[model samples]
Target: MDEVAAAIADPVRRHILTMLRDESLSAGDIATRFAISRPAVSRHLRVLRESGLVRDELVGRKRIYRLDPGPLAPLAEWLAGLAGGDRWERRLDALETEIYRTRRERRARGPVEHRREHTA
Candidate 1:
């Protein structure tokens, strides 16, 4: 999971994953989409492969890469846990209630008292 997160932390690698999500692409095809060198793209692919986010198959002389998506399950679950159950809505409702309570208390206090200070 750490490796998956690390691999996904790179913008280039994330883009690569998106590229491979719908369909597999040859290494050369993937490299051509980026301005970087083939070797550099290959290195990114290697990191993704090691992270289990991607899988590669050699088709004839070309290597085809595709998104694995299996390793991402843990990350997705962790994110969902972070989101909690209706956490945002509950927090907002609590805040609104507090605001209304404060307003009601202020209203119950009636008018503010003003005291004049005498010069020493």
Candidate 2:
């Protein structure tokens, strides 16, 4: 999971994954889409491959890459858990504010003092 997270952390690798999402592309095809050198794109592909986010096939003299998306399942679930926890945290925060407001209002209104009549 750590490897998959780290792999997707880079913008280049994310873009590569997006590119491969639709269709498999040869290494040269992917490299051409970026302004970086072919070796740099190759390195990004290597990271994705090592993280199991992508699969590569050797066809003739070219290596074609495609998205695997299997390793992303755990990461997606973990993120969903965080989102749920965040919603609960927001609710708790609102409840705390309401409790404090109610206490302050009660304190302000508590025990009205009686006025003494002065008969002179």
Candidate 1: stretches off by over 4 Å: 85-120
| Candidate 2, run of 10 with poorest lDDT | 111-120
Q: What local distance difference test score does each model get? A: 0.91, 0.92
Query: Which pairs in model 1 have colliding backbones?
Result: none
At residue 42, give the lDDT of candidate 2.
Answer: 89
RMSD for all candidates, in order, please. 7.3, 7.7
Error of 2 at 86 (Å): 11
lDDT of 2: 0.92
In the range 85-113, model 1's lDDT, one tens digit per residue, is: 67888899999999999878767766452
Which segments of candidate 2 are over 4 A away from where they belong?
85-120
Query: Going through the candidates in order, what is the number of backbone clashes in each?
Result: 0, 0
Superposition error at 73 for model 1 (Å): 0.5
